[model samples]
Structures are given as C-alpha cells and as structure tokens.
Target chain A: MAQSADAKAYNAKVYVTLRPSVLDPAGTAVRSGLSHMGYDNVSKVRIGKYIEVELTAESEVAAKSQLDKICDQLLANPVIENYRIEILEAVAV
Target chain B: MAQSADAKAYNAKVYVTLRPSVLDPAGTAVRSGLSHMGYDNVSKVRIGKYIEVELTAESEVAAKSQLDKICDQLLANPVIENYRIEILEAVAV
Candidate 1:
C-alpha cells in the first residue's frame, strides 16, 4: 500500500473477561457438556469476547490511548468485566 | 485447597478469529460506531471469541491435546475460524 503522509496504522487486540467472583452460567453449561462427553476432568470454563481493532493515528501513544478509551466506553462492561489491551504491530497506511 | 492424589490442573486460554477473507458484520458495525464517535482513522476490525478452560489432567501435554480437540470440535468453526490455544500455568489440585 502507498504510504499516506499522515496515516499511521496500529492493531489492537482487546480481551474482555468476566470477573472471577461472578457466576458464569454459560461456562457451567459448557463444563457440564464436557463432563457428559466423558471429559470429566474439566472443571471450570469461562467465556468472554475478543476483539481486534485496526486504526490510524499520529503515534503509537495516540492509538493506545484511543484504544483504551474505546474499550472502556464501548467494548467492555466495566462493572462486571475487565478488559486488557495489547498493541500489535503498527504500520504506515 | 488440599491436593488430590491424582488431580493435575491446567488452564487453557483460547482465541478464535475469523479467517481474513471472511466478512465480519459485527466488526463492521463496531467500526461504523467508532467512526460515528469521530475515530475516522479506524480501518479494519475483527470480533472473536475468547474462552478460558480449567481442567485436570495427568500432564501439560495431555491438557494441550485435549484443548486442541475441544477447540476443533466445539470452541471454533474450523471451516471459517482459526483458533489458537495457550496452556497457562499448571497446578496440582
């Protein structure tokens, strides 16, 4: 791709996980399913959402800050879930 | 927790992502939402599933093998989605 004068691209991998203290009904159902399938050793399972975001910004710092804001505002529920953001490779767009 | 004579605990973190060629409507929706929020620089976005599984096994290798099978059979749609598995810290149960 041709480089744009001001286009800086960054990829963010965001992980949203439920708090450990909360009950996970879906996870429990999956666990029960595993047990029924003879995987009785399986004990606990937790399900969460994973998001990959690609954006352009002026700098890596700017992309990271924006990703944090996005995660906080829309990607995750702060009251019951915790989100972690990892900045992947950045490239010029 | 008291140790069980034969219980070996392993945690698995799995990431499931759609193949690059596939269309991701959910991701596109999120991208549109971000653009509405003034993040015009945002380009590509992908949405995936994250799962955490805790199990008891004889060894890490055993747990990993089982996890691979689980991901293949239930956790991911192998035809369109790719999955990566990471074996987290193992502990005696």
Candidate 2:
C-alpha cells in the first residue's frame, strides 16, 4: 500500500545485492576486465542495482513498512538476493 | 495490475535513461575519465539505471503494460527520462 493524498512525500533508495553465497559471474567478469585494462589497484567487486522510488506516506515508519513489502514481495529475488533501503528525502504533506 | 496465481512467470529487464536533451554530468565525468585512462574507444556517455523484475502475468503484453505503468508513473522522471523494457524470460503457468 502507498499513502493517502494527505500524506507526506518521501524518496527511497533501494539497493539490491546478490546473496553472499550466490556466484556473481557478471561482477567477476567486470572486475577481471578492469584489471586487464590496467586497473590493478581494484580489489573485490560486487554488482548490485540501485532503484529510486518516490512515495507519499503517512510517516517514516509507515513508509518504510510499505517499501519493505514492495521489496520483499515484488522487487528483489529473495532466494538469491538481499536488499537494503534508505529514505533519501522526506517532505511534509 | 498483475496476474493471478494461474498466470505464467515472466522476467523483465527495464532500462531507464535520461532524455537526450538532459544533462548528465556524471556520465560525462565517467566518459572523460575513461578516455583519459586510455579507453579512447568510448565516445558519448549517458548514465542510466537497470532493473530486473519478476512477475506472474497472464501474457507478455499484460506484463509489459504493467511494467510501463510502474516506470512512467513511479520509477522514472518523465520530464527528463525515457524508459524501455524487455521481456527476458517466460515460463508456463
């Protein structure tokens, strides 16, 4: 659920990452390619996605809960990925 | 709108891009930096976002429309960005 018209505005940054146990071949390929291209100082590499979502919500807690539902039930693949979300901006109704 | 449990499984790859007229300083920085670092093959640069979404949808067309709504109304800044979505996989119900 989102929010009613009277709710405040909020911006969320959702980060999705592959689970530690999952093999990220794409990330590995990118890192190896960078190294070959002379970026020797580069260390470990992990690939993730960044999603920015805007919502109108009643409160921070309510907003976070709604976002969690979106992530767990709709966005990220729970079996292979873990996600973290941060509230980037909040504005009064 | 999504599909019922009896629908097929669909995976989507959504690409979000800044409109051609929009300024992308971050992309500029990356491209210039890469050229300076010897990736001279690079020409123009535009920074964008990619999202992978999995869903149960009745058909490809329905899934695409749902994803379009999500992108146009929720995910992208229509004033400055345009988006394209591709159906990557589909499995029987």
Write candidate 2's Cα lDDT for B59-84 as tens digits.
77877876686677655689999888
TM-score of chain B of each: 0.89, 0.85
lDDT of 2 at B2: 32
Off by over 4 Å in 1: A1-7, B1-7
DockQ of each: 0.58, 0.04
Q: Which pairs clash in model 1? A: none
lDDT per residue for candidate 1 within A16-83, as digits (tens), equals 99998888899899889887877888888999999999887777787788888888888898889999
lDDT of each: 0.85, 0.66
Across B1-93, the per-residue lDDT of candidate 1 in tens digits comes to: 233587688889999999999999999999999888877778878999999998877778888988888888788999999999988767667
For candidate 2, give the lDDT of residue B13: 66
Worst 10 residues of 1 chain A by lDDT: A1-10
Candidate 1, residue B8: lDDT: 80
All candidates: TM-score of chain A: 0.88, 0.88
